[model samples]
Target: MADEITVTVVDDHPAMLVGIEQWYAAAPEPLRVAASGATSKTAWLPPGDAADVVVFDLQLAGQTTPAFGELRRLVDAGRNVIVYTMRDDEQTALTCLDLGAVTFLTKTEGADHLVSATLAAARDRPYTPPALAGALSANTSSDRPKLSIREEEVLVEWFQSESRDLVAQRLNLSPKTVTTYLDRVRLKYANAGRPARSKAALVARAIQDGLISVDDL
Candidate 1:
């Protein structure tokens, strides 16, 4: 609340954190780097404090699941949160959006985009990339694939080799729906030019892309 925007950066890499701090230091506005953390214990900031923006990385060393809970806490307390990470899967992106992230910036994105996203989030606006926004909006876009939540569940079960009947019973979905979901998955892979010929191949692709870990399935 000191007129200048205050930001906290959370990442497991020290060099990345320092680089981000340096970027803010050179910004035109008086940007304050409040706290930097490589772990959750060090990242926890008091609610309703001087923080105006929080740049969070989904993955941390020694932690399995992304720290969505902590990020959600910050958003619930009225702090703007930006999920900056190497992860760019649709499911993970959707999860971050659902958990109230103001922006999602992949590490592969340019530095200019990162700075722009930070500035936009500071102003309390959604700062998603145009491509990502379009992908999420155009559910029927031929270039993009869409997966229902149930389809994702089915994919996970298929990855685990769960029987169709067992998967339907477990997910409370009809067996017919499960088959439909599998067909959709095949169609998606075919569109991408890497059709999975078998259920094992599908699971391998999913795990390799960080869509769903083996333990998750």
Candidate 2:
């Protein structure tokens, strides 16, 4: 379908591939696993199933080709990517970001986070899982910032609202004000070195931080 966000997963472990397929089996509309394989060469995106994003694992069967090298090529080919791997080191995460990965999510972050990361990537956004987000700031000893009460109210309302204007109206704020607050949230994340960089990414962060649930989307 035109609206379906196609995905290609590259992981050597058979069970992980199965697990992701099962998780997305119930994902909301507009997301589908188009194809998968154990290595980049074997991974294929069929003519009808051109992938929008690739969920790649760092370690593959051969291990000769660095996953980052594959990532750069896929991204250069105009495909978004969410790095799904067991390694969660800040250095590797930073390298992935530098290599143009849309997001870097450790497998331990849970299936929901992986799904959310793909959604964010498809939307041209960056999603940093909570732990990874914090890792970005570890070098500077920076603590994650708290959103103001108004910011929290706006975010929750926006997530639950049918429209931004509706959220603004319900919050007794102007549409511009709502936008400003959301921008602030984005800026805060960026300033902390955990840049969310897009609306959908912020939504993912909201879910990660317990500010909202998947149902809220």
Candidate 3:
């Protein structure tokens, strides 16, 4: 991480907005609050400039998009999101990660820790507080599925290729066969208590399984 890092903060509470701004203001040379907004609808992007990481609150005021949907919106906009909220349970943390959060932090942790976590996330490393770490660790275990050689080939190609048909063409197999292998992969994940129901989720699983690195995405 750089000695100076830029961040954009999204929170719904007025006090929280002030508190976070003050927190970042007091942080050491490592953290800088580049921009901040009090609502999820607040624009994160500033023309010709972008933040290194986005620290966000999951619960926004009013009836708005789902937590993960808002998270996806930030990521899809090309900002790495660090979920900092009161909803620090394992399920919420993992789900945010599933939707592509760079890391998760609880609101109760010290402001210094939040600054550190934000810095770590800016460097593409996840900083899991000990409490949330347990849940993430529990999701991957020895029972994690072992794919057959062909299945591995299909999955690897699927990860590398842009589409299923392209994967099929490259592997010289019918699209149907490719689908079958990918389906089995999903089943195996489900059997292991790891449910990857979407293509994005499967890509996350591939990263967890060492099948691909973050950069490959």
Candidate 4:
């Protein structure tokens, strides 16, 4: 059997810490909960005794934003980090990626998804949630046409609907207007080389941009 994976969880919430510990405790393979930290003040063990995966909350009580430097320290020392946070803002997500987090999972996600992300992180693979993955890929290019507030609104309403007519009614726009907005969205994506073909794809892109919540959809 492969060796048991070691994990460290860092979050201010005691319940969350215990919950995560319990999940690892019940895994089929030997899954060790190496350590838990509620704050950055705690001493992080060296790589030898350190965890293979670290699940951290991007925003702690005292921290307004994610401490990318601290996260970078762990990565540089050969540890992988999975950001488990409630903040689903697009800039925050992009910053976390730029700072080298292996994966970003929202607290709103189910426990199973968290466990899967944890395991994937242990394997040195990125575990971006499908909703967020679509979002991130959509915003890759700087040259993509900027979406106006009205256009964005139209796009959101369109994707959230089961039918184009429904979307048009909700947005107080005609079907032709909705179609025009969608066409523009498609052209923008195509020009940026990140075209989204379907409503699901569009939803994903919206999530990545932090325009919509994964739970909202």
Count the clashes in each prediction: 0, 0, 0, 1
RMSD of 2: 9.7
Please say which candidate is ahead in lDDT: 2 or 4. 2
Q: Which parts of model 4 are misplaced by more than 4 Å?
A: 41-43, 46-49, 137-217
Q: Sorted on TM-score, highest at the top, how do the candidates line up?
A: 2, 4, 3, 1
For this target, which candidate reaches the highest TM-score against the unseen true structure? 2
Model 1: lDDT equals: 0.62
Record all residue pairs in model 4 with backbone atoms less than 3 Å apart, i.e. clashing: 135-208
| Candidate 3 residue-wise lDDT at 45 | 52
Query: How do the residues 1-217 of candidate 1 rate in per-residue lDDT, one tens digit apiece?
Result: 4678877888899988888888887877777778877764444545325567788888988888877787766666566677888776766665565556666677766666667678766764334453334235433535555566765667667545435688788888887667656544433432342221222343455466554556744
Query: Once superposed on the true structure, which residue ranges of model 2 sit more than 4 Å away at CA?
Result: 42-49, 64-66, 140-217
Instruction: List, residue by residue over 20-39, the lDDT tens digit for candidate 2.
Output: 98888777756777788887
Write the residue-wise lDDT of candidate 4 on 1-217 in tens digits: 2588877787899999888878877776667777777865442754324677788787888877677777666655555777888876666665565555666677876677678777756754334453334345456457545776766666556434525588788878897677566544543443343221222333455566554566743
By summed lDDT, which 10 consecutive residues of candidate 1 come out lowest? Answer: 190-199
Candidate 3 TM-score over all chains jointly? 0.59
What TM-score would each prediction reach against the true structure? 0.58, 0.63, 0.59, 0.60
> Per-prediction RMSD in angstroms?
16.9, 9.7, 13.8, 11.2
